[model samples]
Target: MKNESQIFGIRAVIEAINSGKTIDKLFIQKGLTGELSKELMDLLKKGNISFSYVPIEKLNRLTRKNHQGVVAHIAPIAFHNLENLTLKVIESGETPLFLILDQLSDVRNFGAIIRTAECTGVHGIIIQKKGGAPVSADTVKTSAGAIFKIPICKVDHIKDAMFYLQASGIQIVAATEKASCPIYDIDLTPPTAIVMGSEGKGISNSVLKITDHMAKLPMYGEIASLNVSVACGVFLYESIRQRL
Candidate 1:
């Protein structure tokens, strides 16, 4: 995936977002007192774009330009729509394997999961646009370039993506410590979509309610949980095992 093209001017960024370009993340200089800046902010608020308010130093580091106190990093990967990607997978003569990240924020974890997903032959990955890590330099580095080869779909909401997957005959499985069934027990050979949550919290109740199965990794150790990325690898490999 190509790195997102940077647009520094406030109006240029606002126009790009308005024109339906996927902005990876926006950096707005803190404490701007200009009418154009205020107008740009209003557009961001209306569009519900995710952005960080940072000091001018950060903006300068991004570019030596007078950035007008604004810069939006375009998405490195051209994100496909969830429904379209799901349909393409169904038509591709293979079982659809999807990894859905629920509010997972760590860049390393995100990248590691992408690596595992790509190696395991997951057809696509679905992530909520807001809570997941944006494709940054560190994510690309951590993924070891796997991010470039995988198809990542950014959705408006997790629940909506789940509905689309289910409608397309994809089983939604939640991998968490709270599941009654062990991951090894679930039949992952079918067309399946596995949902992994953030490190701090497991899958949200709103999403868990809609899952077709809830499976947990069996543990026999003092520490009750595993790192989110490691847990993801276990679930993904289990699916590969079942498929074999």
Candidate 2:
């Protein structure tokens, strides 16, 4: 079975990369060695594209066709360049509201966040190129088509994006349980980028250190943590509330 967004075979994958296709995820059979495979590897390194080494069985499961030890999932949408998008947003005279997902791993959570971010007037969503959920067909379905409405930026590093946002006069606000203040206390009216971490791990310590503010939703239940998507909605709406 052929996935609509998937490209198989080393030559095909390499051609896709050269043609500037955004590879959401790539799977290469372990111990794959050939001249074509080497060419793909070189292209991946040049592009800083990440791939996972998996057993041939995994590759077979991904597709029944001849993959030549490589299979790549093409991103459903083109990713925006962070600097270019940020500059455009600032120049447009809009209070730049951005969402930064720090290696969030769940596809459903990712989709929900995108939907909410779009509904809440987020200018863009920034995610790390690696260690996060890929924007796939499932994401498109789960987001209920909101994924196509908003711009998404994939960066090499979360901290680098934070630094760039800060340099652009945007404040970095991280949502985490480890924060001393509640979400309501933060002033979100300025150009702001809210950072949400993975479901298992809240914001990373290094990331939290650079943020202008850290906030948490007040918890009252026995389960102290909310789902990442739910938490994201609360945080985004609070900004909306404060801005309104």
Candidate 3:
């Protein structure tokens, strides 16, 4: 049971890393030991590649082939460099519209947001390297191939990206239910970056502190919150509407 995006076996994973392949995620069986495993660990540390220790059963579930206690998911697409993409967008003379996902974990919701972002004319999407959805085959399918159409960047820290965007004159607008103002009241005509949070936690307090504005979608029904993907569409379209 080999997934096209997955590479198993310690030697194979090490070779992939040595060949400069971007690893989306890596799983090593707990207590895994051997000379090759040692070499893999050393390479991972040297490259700062993140991996998790999991039970042998988990490795087995990932692939039926002999994993040698290691399995790695190759990033389906090459991620863009945030700084370079931002500078390029600014230089192109288009009012930049960027989407920043703060630890968004659901794969389907992530896919849907990517699709919406592509439709709404987002310049680029920025996601944290960890604690976010992987751009797997499912994401490619769910996005209906829009994943390739849009530029996506993986950053070490979401807040750092926010600071860079702000310095680039892009206002950060965070979508959260806790905001005092409705999204419609915010002016989005300028260069903008919309920040959407995780499914469970709307937006972290640390992230909220630095945003230029925080806005909430008007909710009429008893349900207080909307799904992240749906909410993201409303927010992005609002920006589009204001720009138009």
lDDT of 1 at 57: 90
Q: How many pairs of residues collide in model 1?
A: 0
Can you write out model 3's per-residue Cα lDDT over 105-187, one digit (the tens) per residue? 99899999999999999999999888898888888888999999999998889999999999999999999999999999999
Off by over 4 Å in 1: 1-9, 15-21, 27-71
Each prediction's whole-model lDDT (CA): 0.87, 0.93, 0.93
**Residue-wise lDDT of candidate 1 within 93-142, one digit each (tens)?**
89999999999998888888899899999888888877677777777878
**Tens digit of per-residue lDDT, candidate 2, span 147-225:** 9999999988999999999999999999999999999999999999999999998888999999999999999999989
Candidate 3: which stretches are off by over 4 Å?
none
- Candidate 1 lands at a TM-score of 0.83
Clashing pairs in 2: none
- Winner on lDDT (1 vs 2): 2
Clashes of each: 0, 0, 0
**lDDT score for residue 164 of model 2:** 91
